[model samples]
Target: MAEILLPLLVLCPLAASLLVFLSAGRMGARAIGTVACAGVGISAVASIILSVMLLSGPVAGGLQVTLWPWMRVAGLSADIAFTLDRISMVMVLVVTIVGLLIHVYAAGYMRDDPGIARFFGCMTLFVAAMLVLVLASDLLCLFIGWEGVGLCSYLLIGFWYDDPANTAAARKAFYMTRMGDVALLCGLLLLACATGSLRIGTVLASVADGRLPASGVNVAAAFILVGALAKSAQIPFQAWLPDAMAGPTPTSALIHAATMVAAGVYLIARVHDLFAMAAPVMALTAVLGALTLLMGACTALVQSDLKRILAWSTISQLGYMFLVLGCGVWQAALFHLMTHAFFKALLFLTAGAVIMRAGHEQDIFRLGGLRRAMPGLTAAFVAGASALAGLPLVTAGFYSKEMILSGVWHVHFGLAREWTLSGHPLWGIALLGAFLTALYIFRCVFIVFCGKAGTRAAGRTSRLMGIPLVCLSVLSLFGGVIEMPDTLPSLHLFSALLNPGTPLSHADEPVWLVLAGALAPLAGLGVAWVLWGRPSPVMREIPGQAGVIRPARTGRGMDVLYDRVFVQPFRLLAWLTRLDIPGHAITGTGRLTRAANAGILGARAGLLEMLAIRATGTARWAGHLPGLFQNGRVRWYAAWIAGGLCAGLAMAVLS
Candidate 1:
């Protein structure tokens, strides 16, 4: 029964997307919403049932179901397979249950949209793709889902195509992610070449057996890290996410919560075995994670836009996941991933509701004193904000974050005889991030919800919108009790469920470490209270704050840097490539013409002119061939890829 149902986890929503897309204008908004919700809702329910089944069965090894044979050639074979292990179980539950809630909310949020059906279709498709990405046992097969989510992101982010900003954001995300995806593909190919199989277990076995050289392991792991970093929107790749806010709020929520941005962390966690052998790469990952964690927290602090703030917050939280991952605590990385999903989703949805009521106002400063106008929303927002700040003892984020902090403190990476990657330094970065996380989130809360009502909010919260917020809020508040540090009762339910026999808390962990982790958020809350709790105009207009917000909001000019450094240069190269051949041919013709006029070919000048014209025309026709890949049409590019794949396969079979 479990085998029969596993594929449906991805298929349900995929089918819904297809059905809704095919029906198109034939279906009304309500019908479309029903279809979308039913697809994800069924998957969510099945995920719970499967979780029950998994709890009773072998969790470490998991149950596998092969849906179909994908390919076989060149000493390699792949299958369209799914695995329902503890890690995947967590991911499935988060993707489906949280996805279902987001879909339901979106149905209400986008009820009046002319493109509601299209929106739901793309969203359902995205859920299906995310499910595939998590469940696949083969790395090559996983790429299908990986690319699936990227394409869906491009579609959903640009769903409101009339808005130039929205389309640009979508393109930016697509191009930036592709940069990482290319590296990811290279890594997968390297693995396949070395191990003769792309199965997750097989590749790991190859690494353990020393079939793959140390250098190969390091290079492959580095490529995978690049991909994950870009996908999760870490420092260098972090700018795309804030701009991603041009999409609708539900899109933002889904992407931030689980479907898209978190994909990178999940991938790294999945391939931890291989990463473990690449110690230098692992240290690099940890260092990068710390840098990203600090950068995201600082950038998020100065953002005025409501959704952008959350976007940057997502980047920062994901940084913690990577930090633990780099520190070789993949389980802890995943633990935080689950809790972060609950509260972050809660926050995004609550922000959506507030934005809708406030006449689409998104600037936190503009939305003054909303706490009085919409107390329910204010309460919901506060719950999420508290979780975001990881308020000690009460919030799910606190436990998950505590697990992460403890993990960071316990990391034992030795860089050299006298030097090592100490947990204390990274721990310090994470603790500082904690402080900023609380301060910034609470700052938004106190500013937007506490001050006198300046923005006149309209309409009431629909049941659809209110329900997800309420459910997620409850989870955000009480979800942490399942896991606690030694200083507390030492609940280990979450750790046990994730990996049985794994200790809930580190043995003999210093007491002050946990105390410091607890105090950081409290200190942040205190600072936020001192700054914005009283709701004075003077407090709102803090001197020298603009200087910080300006650079931070612009991602410290990373966007401009990208435009100047990468984008402009790429555009120039593509432009040159497109004309390089024909331009040279024409220039040669001009040179010849001048020479002919100089009497070198005076008697045959007419024939020379004819020859020059013919040459120019022929060169123009030939020039486009060199630049076909440079043209920005996706369909044409895909066709090129298809043709290349066919040729490669033919050569392989023939050889």
Candidate 2:
């Protein structure tokens, strides 16, 4: 049963889904919902216990449970095993905890929906798949979980399949992520072929001992990066996430908070040893991460749709996590993942609560003064927003953000220099990204929660949905205390959990360096206040005039220009499929069989051409008739048959 617990951690949700599916279209949906949620909750609690037990002891005794040999062939072996280590334990806890909250929230959020059982079933399946992904001990197992989560994402995104937009968004997400999945799969295959092992620990050991070739390492790293960028929605592959907001808000929260997007960070962190071995790969990771961070923050600054803005923000924050990992701050990256799941989940659930109250309206421009109307939700939003802005103290975001900045700072200096090219100047770019993060977060907060209410908020209101908001608000504030690192002194509980590969080179940081890190968030908040503190003519002036739309049409927006430059050419090639074929060409394929009809002049001429070819061939080589089927009307058909008969007669006579 102890070994069974690990498998049960994943199977519970899957079994629950079967029960849910069978119970659909009946009052049994309620019971199914309760069982599914309870099953997941129980798994989450068990996983936490496993994590705590592992963390309290040595690596050998930590949560490593193997059931049976999953495969054995060609000197390769993969076990159907689950390992509960420090990193994955953290991830599963977040996935299950946040997943449960969303489920409860959905109980009220989707109460009136016609497809309640279906939705709950998908949710359970998603949780099960995600648990397997985090728990898998090998790359092949991880990928099964990987693709499983992606499949669930497509289903959830288009849960309302009646809407063309939802279906389109779902397709976009699936296709875009599949591009990454291909790369990831190729990389994993390369790793297996090179080392003859797909186990995580074995791969890390080989990489660290310099047993693998650098070229193979680079190829694998690059392939993995392609998948990470695609899955995490980094630049060039990021457009799908914003469009993905067409799904229910819970789907948005799940994707952004725990499962789909987080998989990229998980992959990188899980395989940090391989990344460290390939110096060029590490540099590429840093550059890509920094670029995605800036791009996402800049886009978030200008977005008006609340969900779309949050969508971009998720990409930006994930970029930050990637940046931390890229700089070789493994613990800091994981810590940020922890805090991010809490606050981002809180923000999204709060957003869901607001949308529920407002009859599905999600435009920030149409929302204001919610602080007075829905105090619980407003407070939760503020708490999450403040954490996002990296405000000091009383927030999990505070600890995580500080640790990430500290990691960046360590990279900029000479500390934590395990990987080559250690002293790159990308840390400055990362700091600028931090500033942008605070600015855009507050920009959304000020616009949606602080001002006067708009038409959308007039009648939409509810009290039952407020509970998750309050619960997540508390988590968002204090969750940082759970995993505090030693480098940051504010909250220091779990500092040892995140040990930098090396210590801080200097015992003390300069006053200005510390001040700059502290001040980045404040500066961002100020910039947000200046832009969105009060609505000005800039908001009202552009829509009616051709001033803005003309440039957008002319491709002034950098993103649009980038799409045209890099992606549109392929789109143009695909556009050829849309050409209007004549109905005759499309529908008259069978008419070709009637070409030898006797009524047509064009068909009759074809018999002479066939006879000439047969005569020419006979003169050369005893009469061969290769073109006997090129018949014209009935005359052509008769000539074709006569030519074949004459050729046969001549051949027989010659013989």
Candidate 3:
């Protein structure tokens, strides 16, 4: 059963999606949704059992799960396989479980939507694609899953196709990430060409065994990082994510946090051996990660839309994941990946609850004191936000983030023999990013739960919604225990789960470094409270100073800078291609061809007349053709030619 169960996870949801499409009009939409959700639920359960079975045994045994041969062409062969080791198992479990919950929540959140059946179909297909992504053993198979998820995201984000803005946002997200995917495709080809194998485990093992060239790894790694950066929404590629809020909340949670966006981090972790060999690429990845964190944090400070803030924060948190990867802490990145999934998914769901109550109003300013009206929802939100802010001792986010920062700091502090600190720029960036994370998170919390409630009372939420929120909140609070040590002096429990066989060494750290890491978030929280907890009369009196306003208060202005920088130039180039170069060349070549082909009858007539005159018995006259061909011959010459023609005709007739 277990052997066949792996393949079922990928096929069942897909078949269900087809069934959903067929049943769309004939059956009740709710009934169709229930069936779709059940399929994902079953797959989720199978995924969990598989994860447990794998982790409980030897790591080698854990990595063995080949469903079948996927493709074979020439020298490159890829198998449709599933590797159930600790990392892949963890990701697979998170994707399926969180995906199923979001599916359930979508049942309520999108009940009134007319495209309910279509929505479920897309969601089911997305889960299926993500399952293949985590389970696949080779790059070719992984890419199929990768592009499949991207397609599903495009479809779901623009689910409300009637809205042009939503459609445009969806297009923007797809195209931008596609640019990165191209680079990644190149990287994969480079790897296959150099190593002669597309199997991830094989490549990693070869690299680790020193059987591969560092130069090959370096170039391939660089290409992979490009894909990772674009997919993860790191820095320059991040603007699309905030704009992605045009999607429904459940779609937002499922795609952004639980599945689609996290593929980048999972990519790097899956290829840790390659990255370890490519030091230059790793360093660049780290730098880009730091930038993503800062950009997301800074942008989130002024966001008013609840989902947008979370979106930016998601990007920022992804940055931390990449930063840890650069520090050679693959396990830490994977841990953060798990914890971030729980908390971020929770935050998005709770935000949906509030927004749902407010009649779909997303501006934080319009929403306040939700805690007073929706106590359970408030507690859930706080728990999730606490984890996001990495608050002390209450959530998994703390342990994971702390571990990452510790790794970053260690690398920045000249711990690595080949690397030296030239003032530790990455460490400083990490601290600033942490402070901003806390500030914006508290701002989000305080704005929504601390002041005055919005127009609608919080009692409007359904039990289905509230129950999921509560479940996520409990997970957010206690999920860390699975990763925490029983005693402080004992080894950190996550160390074993994250790095199964790695050696651990204890070291004394500088007090100031420790203080900076500890106090940064506290300071951010304090700042948020002072500014937003209780607005002062004097502060309110200051006109035109709306720095305290939530980010979306600016509306489309949120993406205006992006349009000016990226979109406008892109549009201009497109216009130039259409109207300037290719357009002109096409027009010009068309005009020339038309001229050469035109007046064919007139040209043929002139040629025939010339031939007739030349063929006549007038070789001597033909020598004087210039005069004969002229229209205005003299009257005497015309009479002489007429008489000569008559004589010749009479002679031929007599003969």
Highest TM-score against the true fold, candidate: 1
Residue 69, model 1: lDDT of: 93
Tens-digit lDDT track for model 1 on 351-416? 999999999999888888887789999999999999989999889899889999999998889766
**Compared with the true structure, what per-residue lDDT tens digits does model 2 show for residues 412-512?**
42223563444336667767877888887887787777766674554443444566667778888988776544444534444455332333232454556
- Residue 155 Cα positional deviation in candidate 1, in Å, after optimal superposition: 0.8
Q: Residue 571 CA error for candidate 1 (Å)?
A: 3.2
- For candidate 3, report its TM-score: 0.84
Cα lDDT of model 3 by residue, 151-213, tens digit: 999888888889998999899899988988999999999878766689997778878887768
In candidate 3, list every pair of residues with a backbone clash. Answer: 302-551, 303-550, 303-551, 304-550, 304-551, 304-552, 368-452
**TM-score on alpha carbons, each prediction:** 0.88, 0.81, 0.84
Residue range with the least summed lDDT across 10 consecutive positions in model 3: 536-545
Minimal lDDT window, size 10, model 1: 534-543
Say what the RMSD of model 3 is: 9.5
Candidate 2 backbone collisions, by pair: 357-460, 485-495, 603-632, 603-633, 604-633, 618-623
lDDT of each: 0.89, 0.76, 0.80
